[model samples]
Target: MGYSEEKLIEEKVFKDPVHRYVHVRDRVIWDLIGTKEFQRLRRIKQLGTTYLTFHGAEHSRFNHSLGVYEITRRIVDNAFASRPEWNEGERLLSLCAALLHDLGHGPFSHSFEKVFDLDHEDFTREIILGDTEVNQVLSRVAQDFPKKVAEVIEKTYENKLVISLISSQIDADRMDYLQRDAYFTGVSYGHFDMERILRVMRPREDQVVIKQSGMHAVEDYIMSRYQMYWQVYFHPVTRSAEVILTKILHRAKHLHEQNYTFKHKPHHFYSIFEDRMTLEDYLKLDEAVFLYYFQIWEEEEDEILSDLCRRFNNRNLFKYVEFDPAKEYKKLAKLSMLFEQAGLDPEYYLVVDSSSDLPYDFYRPGEEEERLPIHLLKKNGEIRELSRESDIVDAISGKRRTDHKLYFPSDFLEKEKARPEIEQIAQILELNLDNGTI
Candidate 1:
């Protein structure tokens, strides 16, 4: 149904833990959600292997999709409903962009992207504009409707207000994911005054800005982002899982390149290795399919592949200790030789995981690709960048924090004969032997 005239006879509601309730009033949004492509997100974990570390984080991308749609709905109705700066005609575009933003995300999104050199953003655009149910649904609104939605998602839509609602620093997408992720992970750090923030959010000439009164809420939001980055997003154990998964794919590709016969054909991964996957083939993949492959790969003839698959499946994650990259590289290189002496291939057995993030930053004068700085609307009608007005934001602005860890299978080192060398290496690295060391 085109925007000209279409309405659902009854409203639909999804009980969401983060948003409480996700409401659907339009038949088009409802139909789009029911499509096979959209339903596939139900089988994909939003945080991927992070669930292995945070047991409560089992929520799916489908849950997040609804949360995002709900957030967008609220922003439209509560924040911009009667505002002259916000065009009522752009409501559907905003909703569509929010609902379908992560549509092209494959299983274990970032890890998959690293292993396969695939860009989820490109695929997202393709899914919205390609020959599929999503494209067909958008086309029903108008011949150019799909392109319009794509432009909004790409942040190139002529309507700057509409683009900002979905893509801004404090927009609905980030607001939904942070709160939703925190809810699923059972962590309190992600909680912020979303209601207060939304209430104070007003449309400016070409973008959205928070009122001066909501500056604290914005600071809290930034702090929440900082904590989530350190505690959940860049957790070393999660990165260990990622490292192992990446190695597994690398090993599989290596084996295939060497013409080693696989006991079970990796049909799903064939196109991935060849870099020729069609949208249809990519859509067929989800966490379930990948997990199934891992289960089968555990019995593979290759020891490295089999071991990695087993570790990933059983959650026997690599043990890690803090490492100083600049000072420890030479020592780490020597440790690799020691591992080789002990018959463990350092390439597959030892991993260095480094995670870095910028919690907040101010706009640099000539920075090529800087974020649109968060602006606060003062009581006197003057706009000031957040860090300029808030001490907390100022303290952390443009500051980047990073962590480095060295991961290895400590259980392998426990073998009686290898214990001495392992202990010596651990001592040399000044690794903590306490329970929290891992």
Candidate 2:
């Protein structure tokens, strides 16, 4: 629908939780969303295990994909389309890139990628460049339209303006997810004055820059990002579910490796177990299929598998203790031995989950895959980095903060409460047994 007269007769709309209404006008955008590959996003939850913690967080990637497109649409169409430097030819490419950005995310993407060493970006490129309906629909625009879309998503497009619009420290994708996720999770921290930010956004030679007047709004957005990472993204209960999910996959892989006969063979996981997951193999595995397997594994002969499956299905999550890995290595080692002695495989049972956040972090002179910094353009046309212009963001500029948690089954420990080793483990961590917590 680029530079053409064959546009949709009427615009379509989707009622969105964050943006209110997501408007769609391009025929190409409509067709790409209808592709079977894109529709698969409907089955994959946006926050994976977070739904276990926030019941309202049942929204899927499809919900987020549409939100991203809507944000980008507003930014491109209203914010920068009429600018002298804005290239009209790149409009469709930007829309397509935003729409298909997360098309390759697998079921429980973070856990799947961590366990299987799969890069969703690689698959995103493959899906767009390979033999698929997404590619076919994108190709209808032009022979090289798919490649252009891929380039934008990959952040390798010659047009820095396009890349910055989608992948910057503050961009449509992040903007959409922050509010969308907060809305679904029933949190109030992610709200920011996005309308003002858009009004003040200007395209620079190298990136998107905000007017100095909107600096306060940009700072608010940064603080909101920091809060969400701590409050929502790094919730202990969600990570507990992730730990159990990871162990389930690990136990299944181990069983397959040892030639342990499963009552219900996990044919769906064969390719993943071998580390040779094809696109078809990846597509076959969704949240539903995973739940199906977890249900069946609950009855498997192996105690580890059966127990973990039941734990995940019943929300019997592992209890965690705030741990300092640097100072508690020996304590952790002793706990592992105690877990093994208690008949809980330390490898699968004792999980150390770490989450790190770099608030207001941006691209350095020489850093790998560095994110471009947010800039505020002054009234006199001079620009300054966001940290220099905002006191709040400056407080923790580019500093990485980390939290480590030790997750294990408290029920298992309580069952062996009388054991000397279990008592020692509790004493080592100074467990608050009176309150039934660590």
Candidate 3:
């Protein structure tokens, strides 16, 4: 039998918290899961730096990846199998795309990506198409199979139905992560009637639509996503930790550029620091590797680098206050100067971060990062965009909300407040009255 068609003598079942059981029967899937590249996900956390905030949020990407695969499998084999719109030939391709979509996420995910200008999606394509174990295993099915898998994950596959199953507004990836993250973190915000939504899904030529009967369940799902973003994902404490983490990366790179010698050489980070990190170099990185360097850098000679590393390791995160970027520009400038006078480097110690979200948006052409809107299928077989049919959805649709915060080392500012030289700046910030939290 061909590798793609080969089934295991017995189905392999993974007992999962979110999906209950991830059943694997195809030899191709079983082999791909055993590949070293996929195994590396076990060492990478699903929610980076979130464990510090939600202590139970220690689940790894390997767990979330398998949940995503299982959700896609259910949609393909259970919901859409007999539907005329779903091509049976695309089943394996969809499963592969769902499982490998997050294959290239680095340690600390977004924070690391921001500092180094790395795109995990770019690395994801490289891993599937380059000379790697994942590619080798995929090549066994067919010479072009690996490219097909990569294209599906990249949202460039010709099969629009397959792309929509993974990338659309309410797809398998988000479905898995929302419930999975909520389960691990013990939060109720990500909960919704997923089973009902899955049952009512109808496949279309270009996208997936929900049966009219399932509108309320879909509404619940949307609200769950909106709440999860503000309550759990964008928790202020989590952002503070991320701010410290980003500074550590920035300080290390700056030191590297200045020819600063390290007491403990950063062998794993040298390629990344040079911006020439190869596939091999990237594959060698995981959270454990980063923690090792951070542990040793605590004693490094560079005060900024060592201080930032110490703060991250010890959980001494910076405190923040509400900031308005448009109106508070002068206040921010004054704070930066005061931070410097108080023996804190404004670049490393004073920072501003913003978080924003669009609860739901309808299709808008010619806009950057255009997203496919959700559609609901009527009883007469006609389809309507979700917002048009549901009053609840229309209320918040197309609205964007944003928040900004100014972060600084309140401990240093408190000490400097009593000093005559920097007292004026400290009072301007009201550190003495509020103890630095707002």
Report, for all candidates in order, the number of backbone clashes: 0, 0, 0
lDDT by residue (tens digit), candidate 1, 129-154: 99889888888888998999889888
- Measured on C-alpha atoms, candidate 2 has an lDDT of 0.85
Which candidate wins on lDDT? 3
* Root-mean-square deviation (CA) per prediction: 2.6, 2.3, 2.3
Give residue 193's lDDT in candidate 2 (0 to 100): 91
Clashes of 2: 0
lDDT of each: 0.82, 0.85, 0.86
RMSD of 3: 2.3
**lDDT comparison, 1 vs 3, better candidate:** 3
lDDT of 3 at 181: 88
Which model is ahead, 1 or 2, in terms of TM-score? 2
Give the alpha carbon lDDT tens digit for every residue of 294-390 in model 2: 9999999999999999999999999998989899877877888877887778899888888751122332322353556788899998988888777
Taking the tens digit of each residue's C-alpha lDDT, what string does model 3 give over 292-350?
99999999999998888888899988888877889888887777776777788999888
Point out where model 2 deviates above 4 Å: 1-5, 357-369, 433-438
As a TM-score, model 3 comes out at: 0.95
